[model samples]
Target: MNQQSTLSSSDMPGFQLKALLLLGLGHLVTDLSQGGLPVLLPFIRESFGLTYAAAGAVLMTSNLTSSIVQPVFGYFSDRWGSSWLMPVGILTASLGFSSLGYAPGFWALLLAVFVSGLGVASFHPEGFKAARFFTGKRRATGISIFAVGGNVGIALGPLLAVAGYGWMGLKGTLVFLVPGLLVGIMLIISLGWLSEPQRAALAGISDGSRQGPRPLGKRWLPLLLLILAVTVRSLIHMGIVAFVPFYFVDVLKAGAGTAAKMVTVFLMCGAAGTLIGAPIADRLGHKRFFVGSMVFLLPVLWAFLAAQGMAAFVLLGLAGAVLVSSFSVTIVMAQHVLPDRLGMASGLMVGFAIGTGGIAATVLGSVADVWGVLRVLQITAALPVLGLILALAIPYPYKEAGQSEA
Candidate 1:
């Protein structure tokens, strides 16, 4: 059998299912665990005596480190097994969160969260590789379903953190342990999250078992273009989300709880968008959605600031719903562009895009420093025009999706 054929699933009975559940769960855990910041930023700032800019920088580190580094790890996971990365990353991230609670000072806390993000860098490529191995044709739908759990984590994080912190002290917030533990347990039970049948088929193949991951084949140009577009999209995403809370407080004069809810609304819409985007792609096709997202988001985001109270909330929700759905489109585009390099695709979509966005968020925070939040968001809304052009650069049309799989 050819080397790729050697990967049939019969090699292990439950390996496929286990790998998938665990990997998805791992993604979900970090999403839930690190939610403390957005929920408690105001409190943390008051406690730490931080200015808005400084606190935003710390949050930026956690986000950027993972964003920037995930692609590197994605490339690695593509060549190596992702089996242990999730657990190890969770452990490190958990430790980071634990230390964050006890951090004696600001830099200490920032470094801890940054390290947490770095550890998170390991999951995307590895996880996506596993999902691809299983779903084969329906990979986009499958991965979207898996990824939405992360958004669920985002929704739950604030509620849990607030409840935990309310009941406990600083150490109480460390209750992130519960969610992380849930993921570890899920992985072990599933034998890891991959395809059961295919894994067995690959295992039973004729090639005498090899030890390492498959080699990363030739494919760099599309990856580069994907990165450029993804970088811009991610920056717009994080920059707006990061500052919305501040905008709520400073401009709209909303309460901390209200600001947190706005952030939650933005993320929630994103989560819903992803869920809908996946199915939407199944109907309208991915490329169409990719271009359409940019077109719709430009006006929605610009018009959002003009809204007030619940009106702003509804508009932001709609904006998030439409804009974030592009993630499904983008990730699918990346995977399609590099059919054999799912890990790198995941890395580009999840890692670099996020990291670059974090950096952009920091820089934009500075822009907001001078121009004000509304102006920054208004300008940031225009950034996606770059993505629109890049999306147009993507040559494969939706009509070809069915036959495009390698």
Candidate 2:
């Protein structure tokens, strides 16, 4: 294993800041496209006189397709080491999402959603690979920095939707295409710089000397537990996004604008948590920190459900910070488990797990229909117990790879 290639940021003070920032920008743009979709759903529903179930189907289709296909791309990326996917991912994501403004009917919108989902799926595995190339020792921190971009972009989606739809009508969606194109061009121009480390890694892999994936013998148990732990975390985070707005309006009697602001608080705080938690995870150990974060959530979620008004708001932000903080930690762990196939590890961590969360969203919504959103949230509060148990069992598989657990 070429341990020097994965050097710590402190060891190599001259890190690839330009490439990292550009990669972060691409993530921001792609997720911005994704984040905007929920905002557009209401407009589409109003224009088409569609039922809520039908409108939600648009999101479900996109999530389902993306979840299924991302690992395929990841597998290919590992084998081929393709640099084109990232730029192409941005371009296609833009095309699919931008077209939503002009879709004349239900099927047209569905088609657009599918294309946009594909773009999102294509970007992640390669994006994580690219981020790895730039970071040496501060892997969790670097991934967290990259992750904050997506969190910000997703948070910005609703704002863009409001501004675009309010100012220029549905056609305002086209504005998003401009940024995607510009970023894609920037990535293309920066390919030479980004490709250097990737070429070296590939060469190492070709010569059978690289660190990463190992044969899944007894190691499968830890990887499975980690995946399960992440699955629970994703479920809670996504559950908040899916249901919190309604909870605010229906239960707290907040106006639509206020509810929107609260959702923003949840997402933005999650981004902040990514930033704050990374350094802490670096020092405390990823497994211990992740387990502690999930265990801590039990009280946060209970308080959030039990409190009212300002107290609830504070708890919501706290919940967001604690739960979503594990996002990058889990991704880094996945790579450590299967170091050689970074692309595939990213696909499972980012793609497959999120899809599972989407299923949880669907099931939770159905449960909410019968049991009420408040009751359902109380049930969700208990999920972290499972994640905590899994975290305790997550073994350090990368000791052989010469990488320290973050």
Candidate 3:
């Protein structure tokens, strides 16, 4: 790569910085709408008098629906290449999320989340494929830039929910609709921006083919192992996000504001880790970076369990950073494994793997009911060990050809 190629400017081949920024912004709002739901869970529980199990059920419903549909969308994008999906996805997500305020009852709330989840599901496959093209040769850097939008949005969710719910109660969720609509309109207008570059410059990492289909028979073991690794990470992530506030408030006797702030701190630091780790992974090799991150997360989580107050907060932030660093790396690895199926790979890793984790959140909630949430944290701390084991099994790209390991 030359100086000009690394610049990420308008002149760089396949590097449309402006279009990427817009697509990233679109991703930001899409996830912002999704991320706010967990923040709203405690408030919703108190207002509706629901159990931890019920709350977990809500998350399960949303995650499962979103998980199940995303691969279908990815398959379509791979086969037909739809420009309308992105804008429509945003619109659908916005409307579904805005309905949370006046849902009236538990079933209605479930329906709202299901619809909102579908919207979330609709955006990722095509959105990620676009992000891939917008970066050209710098897929890692470009995907990181695009992924940071979701990272920031998810990080902001707790703070936004606290502020919105504090001021306007449940109805405050309607505020998300404004950004959703605005971004959707922008995506519609910028359709040409994504389409043009993809046609002109988009190419696969493993092979130089552009939008060409290829066989996947040789890649099954690696892809399955990759999905399992990603699933474990996502499971730990959603488990913490869904239950940590409850643990802080009920077990630690912390104030609601403090608990929300702690969650925000974790997510924000994770966003920082994504930005810092992506470029390094590009240079140092994805497998090493991912396995090392999971390795570091093990002790950090133990320290988080033992620490108190501000110390706990700091440890939590570190844990978030290490756990999240592999997110984009996993997605990019999936793409490398199935160069012709970028959309499917994106959906499988980003959507389905996350959905599987969301399903596990309910299981975690059930265990919490039996063993207590604090004990659950102790068990959860050991999860990274499993992730590290799987990370080690992720095959080197050149392993089959007897090339030197990365």
lDDT of each: 0.67, 0.76, 0.80
Error of 3 at 226 (Å): 0.1
Off by over 4 Å in 3: 1-12, 200-212, 398-406
Residues 60-109, candidate 2: write the lDDT tens digits. Answer: 77777666577888887887777789989988888888888888888988
After superposition, which runs of candidate 1 have C-alpha atoms over 4 Å from their true positions? 1-23, 168-172, 192-219, 397-406
1-406 in candidate 3: lDDT tens per residue? 1000111223235767787788889888888765788878878888889887888888888888777578888987766666688999888888888888889999999988888888888888989987877776667778888888888888887777777788889988888888899999999997986766444433331234332454566678899998898888988888778878888887888888888888888898988888889889988898889999988999999999899988999999999988888788888888777666767889999998878877987888788888888977887888999998998998856243321232
Q: Score candidate 3 by TM-score against the native.
A: 0.92
TM-score of each: 0.85, 0.89, 0.92
Q: Candidate 2, overall lDDT? A: 0.76
Writing each residue's lDDT as its tens digit, candidate 1 over 191-303 gives 43343443444454434564333343333555566677777787787766667877777887877677777777877888899888887785777777777888888888878
lDDT of 1: 0.67
